[model samples]
Target: MEKIFTLAELVEEYGTEVQKESFENNGNLNRRSFDSIIKRVEQDWESVKEEGRGSKRKIKCSGKLEDKAMKKDGRVRSGRQQVEHRIPMDVIVATHLEYDMTQQASMSLGKWAVEFGLITELEYDLLRSRHSSKLRQKHIDKAIQSGTLEEDQTKLLDEFTQHCLEIYGQLVKTLEHMEKCGIILFYENWMAYGKDGKVSINPEIMKKILKARRELMKKHEVVEFNLTAHRNAKKVKNFNREWKETLAEVKDENGNKLGIKYYWKEYAVILKASSKAVQRYLETYCVDSLEVYVNDKDLFINENVADYELKRKVNIMKKAEKRHKQKLQEYKEQKISFATAEDEEWIRFFYTQQELEDIVAGYDLGVKRLHLQNLYMERMGQLFELYNIKGYNNKKHLEGVS
Candidate 1:
């Protein structure tokens, strides 16, 4: 059986004169200081106790890391302390399972974990602040049901959840956009190996796709939704503003001024609006107009195709026209799902022309899964730059050792 020491005996055995300086004027230990020391010792008891005569008695830390902690002035350095080593503080804390260091670091680690197959998509959702809020409210509701919370406390929590709802709704919109554009699915499919014992479907193709996805995520991580307030359209219309310069009349060679161009104001407003917002507006207001334009087949086909000078060019156009009709028939027959205008626009940003063509033709889930695994490897390389964790960043660092 192991020996157990009471709080008094442990303090008497390990507390130094310097630690005693933190005691109260009445010669009693300060609870805060004592707790701090206890926590530090719990994290690195071996290093703390090894300097004294009672060093032979070993005490284990609750954390997974068993390495001796760095010491300064005979006190164990806590996780919050700045690491003096080559690795970053965040990296060290994450490796030791001390996630409370920083939310940004923890979120980055969560993404890295998903990329490396260390965690599932469901597990990663818990790391998101939006999901965390929902989960908190869930427990709050449960507590209310169980009559565990005071009436005042319950009221406050209910009000808090209501305030969080709007922010949660915004987060859901952005996350749904991510899911629609295949970012979420990409990570989900990454955590698997193929039949050939290789992860990627095609490394060369996936490298480009992964880079595009990374750029997209980085751009949107701190996105401005402009949810609360609208742009000052009233101010833009004022004559005193610089936007008036855009409305300046066009000049002719003879110095005669043309009428003020209305297109400029339209262009300015459209340019200021987000693509999704603009698309939504157009879809709501211009659906009939778009349908009318699309149905005008005469606008698409040239009446004088036979008048072309080059036979090769004419043959190519004919083939294109034939393929168009085939695609229309395929849509009519419902053999393949047709991409919406929004989806097409989104897809153009993330895929190459050839890849988009193949996707429109048909995509195999197995092929996509393989590609995602390749993308995973590419993403892990980027994660290494974010956190300089030794072994995970470089495979060669742990090539031979188990």
Candidate 2:
């Protein structure tokens, strides 16, 4: 198994070279540096003692004996393995502090960490405590100078206080950027847990988180296509024309092709005509009438009158009705003419299916553009927080007076 390096061991062995090469090599601290540090830590592991807990021996397991016992048995046995202290507590704590510092700086400056890699939970806690202590001590010494305490340690207190304040300010800015980007705080916490830590986020959970964040930022707009209505109208006109053409070829028996006259027959013709005429009439006029009736009975009845009273009324009112129908037909033709012109205008104004599809594609492109823009803004905010322009300016003013 590969040995893990404690923070102190990593720093003592590799930190200087990693930091020096990082800027020149585009901020990548190579694996070779880490490997060398790990080698050194493994060589010294037995001698290294745990911090604060005096003279305690490192834990170890007798793996050789366990392997021999397992080989002797025909059946394999399953049980918990013995725990060994592979990495020292001091190293773990130091590594975590270094990682936290690098990460905190990266978040504030919007720059990748060059020297330190990942931190552990113990290190993070230690760094936080050290920061808090320096801040509190600065305040305590200032109070003491105002006769709060007779003796006070004020040496380099102002510089340490400023450094702590700078770090805190950077941390706040980094947190804000993370929030804006929808980055969960749990990632940092998880990293702090170190390699031996078992807690982890599943890939499925991460995918869902990404999806939700994307949806929150997405903006949608509807686009419509007008082809359906136009297509239906065209279908209706084609079907009507086809029905009329089919009805025009009527014939009758007596070997004569019957015209539309054969359609007025009240009963099946006991041929006063040839079989050919009768058959032709039945096939053409009869079939045509039946088909018309099936498609639209109202049209068939309007063009073919049967009642005596209605026929007589039709003859008597024929001239008046023809004039009235002519006027109505003329009015309907004019309405149809106007409607056709309006339809052309509407076709020009509205989107076609092709155009609507293009618009939807443009919306998808906008989503990517918007996400990138937001990310850029978030990164800019992080950089501004790192520099501490306000504090730097205040310090310059105080120095000019001195």
Best by lDDT: 1
After superposition, candidate 1 runs with Cα above 4 Å error: 1-19, 22-32, 46-232, 235-402
Question: After best superposition, candidate 2 residue 165: deviation in angstroms?
Answer: 28
In model 1, pairs of residues that clash are none
Tell how far residue 20 is off in model 2, in angstroms: 56
TM-scores vs. true structure, each candidate: 0.17, 0.13
Candidate 1 positional error at 120, Å: 14
Q: Per-residue lDDT for 317-395 in model 2, tens only?
A: 3433343355344433432122588775775478664454435443232222323234322322222232212223433
Q: Which stretches of candidate 2 lie over 4 Å from their true place?
A: 1-348, 352-354, 360-402
Residue 291 in model 2: lDDT: 56
In candidate 1, what are the lDDT values of residues 221-272, reduced to their tens digit?
3212211111223432232233233323333335444333222000000012
